[model samples]
Target: MNPFLIPRRPWTRQCMLPLGARPGLGTAAGNWQRLQEAAGGLPVPGPATLGNQPRLSGDAACCRVTPRLDRPKPLVFSAMWVWALLPILLVLWGTVGFWLVYAMAVANGSVNVTVVFPYISTCGSDPPQSCIFGQVMNVGSFLVVWISYLRFQQVRDWGCPCALNTAGLVLGLLCALGASVVANFQQNNQLETHLFGVFLAFVVGIVYFWVQAALTQQVKPRHGGGWLGPARFCLCATGTALLVAMCALHGLGLKSEAAICEWALTQSLFLLFGLFAEDFRHIESCCVRLQGRAPSPALELGAASTQTLAL
Candidate 1:
């Protein structure tokens, strides 16, 4: 196939030249000359030209070729609102998974609906529901990691790069790791490891939320914080109080109250993450471009070089 004349899709990096017009060499200057000839001696803009209006000249007047070296716009497929779905999906996955496991345990007589007030881990400690619970938590942890990084980027972009931002990211990751540990190591089988994971996910997780709330207040969004800032602070306060109360209740051998507190705390965390929808609404597109030296002479002169970008 000819290097310069082949038709291409709209999003391609390579520039397409007119059909039947062949250049001497696969160089920018050479292509510019061929394009001029194809336009019947028309003085077409050169590769270095900037902001030149398109001109229609002799024979091929219909085809206006602008050979300027302007930065190419990246192809954007989705709207900014697409990012909001991440938090929603995370919340749905968690809520449904927790309830599903509880229901399954109740049906199988593994847990008593009326007599025993069970923790989320207790509901998933048995057979069939345990498998589903593990899968749900593993997937949720992966989503949490992605959300954490995005939140970190959002804060940095807003010009608030303090220690709190970094701490929030680190704590978010730790909470995710804890969730994964709790998923794989059932409380019934590995009590000590499971307890450690619970501590990481619940204790560290609440602290992470508090850190995020503080950051939200520090770096208000373009449209102002509105309800998001206050809502985050509320969730943070509620989750923290619930966490402390749960610990005290558990230490006092009040298993039922502690279990209720655990459930409430989990929901509060989910709600807190869901509020990130407002934070992500402002992002339209994300692009990654390679930074490398100019193409080698051989690569430029008909040696094929391809690069793929994943979004």
Candidate 2:
């Protein structure tokens, strides 16, 4: 059982060979002495002989020196994701929840989605619909609109032209606040008030994005100037076309055509935010300002010369 012990079962009888008065007895004794010496030379391995060493086998000697470690798989909602990404995701989820309630209402014949021109609040006009709509609006926009306002602040801090930046920031705040008003006041009960909120949010919201887009072009930050460059112009153009189409359809007394255009335009406005996805790095906090202008090429040359002269 022990690694150190030598096998003796096969050799037991041989080991006990008797020395007696017989022919060639002395020669046999010498042979037995030589056999005992060879047995003593056989290797006996033990733990104490080698400190925690793995026992060698066969003709090859190999060693494994290090221990292997197992690491856990990464999670979806890590700390950075929760803090920087969650607010944006929750805002989207909440907005989608509003549409989900609207769909349910349409399914039940409580409201018509396509031709009726129902305001978003109309989804929650009745008892059960109100529960889903209210939670999504109150809880979801609660994070989203404020986050929009903060993101607008980052636009300003990018060192955009003063007047333009202030205008954008104010419009963004109005958009956020107006959405809250629309959420709180049901269109069925307070139609005028809800309409007023819609005007503030929808109209001002576009202006805010326009301003943000202008800022995007003027003062570039490290994270700001990627695919967003082309996306800004495209979204603006698409939104403008949708707005014009909505107006023309409404003028022609096609209510459904106009309403669908209005809904698509709203989605286009949200898509503008997608263009600024770079701003997400600073979403939970304010915009960061770099200390000074990057040294001009001329200044860089001068500094290089100075260093050379010193050397």
Candidate 3:
């Protein structure tokens, strides 16, 4: 979620310290400015000690400290931000790019993406959508795998199961490798290898979703509801089932039906990723924040004692 939209505590008037009318001993010579401090200066007050400290003849001595009114920020490290956006961005980019290329390729009725399209890998052989298709697939698949690995660590951080996380991470990597292979070896170049890569990508992708769905359910109860849990499983199942049906139809010489099934299958897999995006978002390694813990009880007591030192 965007930090700004997370219902954070704005610098409220109630939370701010009142301006003081008296100067402290530390004020400039003869200035006696209300905002100035006395020469002796105010005693140093920690957040917790503010309420208990004796009021001194210094600026804003009666001002109270404010307590944080929001949940403590997570301790995300520098490298974690990479884990957040890469996978999501790559998949979206690839999907959009592929469609753009497909539209261009089919614009003049030069190629039919529905039936004659053996697979996405062979799209490179067509005009207007050549090598770019494979490049997008390769990049997207690589990021997907990396994201899965990062998700494994993220789930672990969320106190999820180790074995399942490991399995999901590994399968995700396998899926990426398969996709990369397909991109590297197009149907015309090496049909067997291309077919194998497609098979590997789909099969491993299904298992990856299965593990990810389980891990998502183990997230802290405070986070959110398990709204996507059943949907995640169903999406994975739908993709896998479509893949099977698409293959069977293709083998039985129903090329057009197979193409539609294949297209829907890919969409289903994409939807599967989207289902758990909310669940794993908090653990993203990218752009993570490091924040201080919640103020202690003493600090709460000092809420009415800490004052704003400046306007």
Please report the candidate that would top TM-score against the real structure: 1
lDDT digits (tens) for residues 41-148 of candidate 2: 543222233333333333212111121334334433223333445445654765588678878888888876555776456667776787777666566455656566
Query: Candidate 2: misplaced stretches above 4 Å?
Result: 1-87, 113-121, 222-224, 282-311
- After TM-score superposition, the amount by which residue 171's alpha carbon in candidate 1 deviates from its true location, in angstroms, is 1.2
Residue-level error in angstroms, candidate 3, position 26: 41
Superposing every Cα of model 2 onto the true structure, what RMSD results? 20.6
In candidate 1, what are the lDDT values of residues 1-311, reduced to their tens digit?
13232222322222333343332324435656665665454455566552233332222212233234457666563678788889999999999999999899999989885885988999999999999999999999999999998889888888896688999999999999999999999998999999999999999998898898889878854433578888889899999999999999999998889999999999999999898888887776666565568887887665333321111
- Find the 10 residues in a row with the least total lDDT in model 2: 58-67
Candidate 3: stretches off by over 4 Å: 1-84, 108-110, 113-118, 220-224, 284-311
Residues 1-311, model 3: lDDT tens digits: 00011112333211112243223333221232322242134232323433333344433233332336666566655543444456467658767977766776677564775557644554454655767778778887867876676677767777777888788888888998988888778777788998898887888788788777777677676243656677777787788789889889989998778877877877777777655455455553444466678799998667534432332
Candidate 2 has an lDDT of 0.60
The estimated TM-scores of all candidates read: 0.71, 0.58, 0.61
lDDT order, best first, reads 1, 3, 2
User: Local distance difference test, per candidate?
Assistant: 0.78, 0.60, 0.63
Worst 10 residues of 1 by lDDT: 55-64
Which pairs clash (backbone N, Cα, C closer than 3 Å) in model 2?
Answer: none
Give the C-alpha miss distance for residue 270 in model 2, angstroms.
2.3
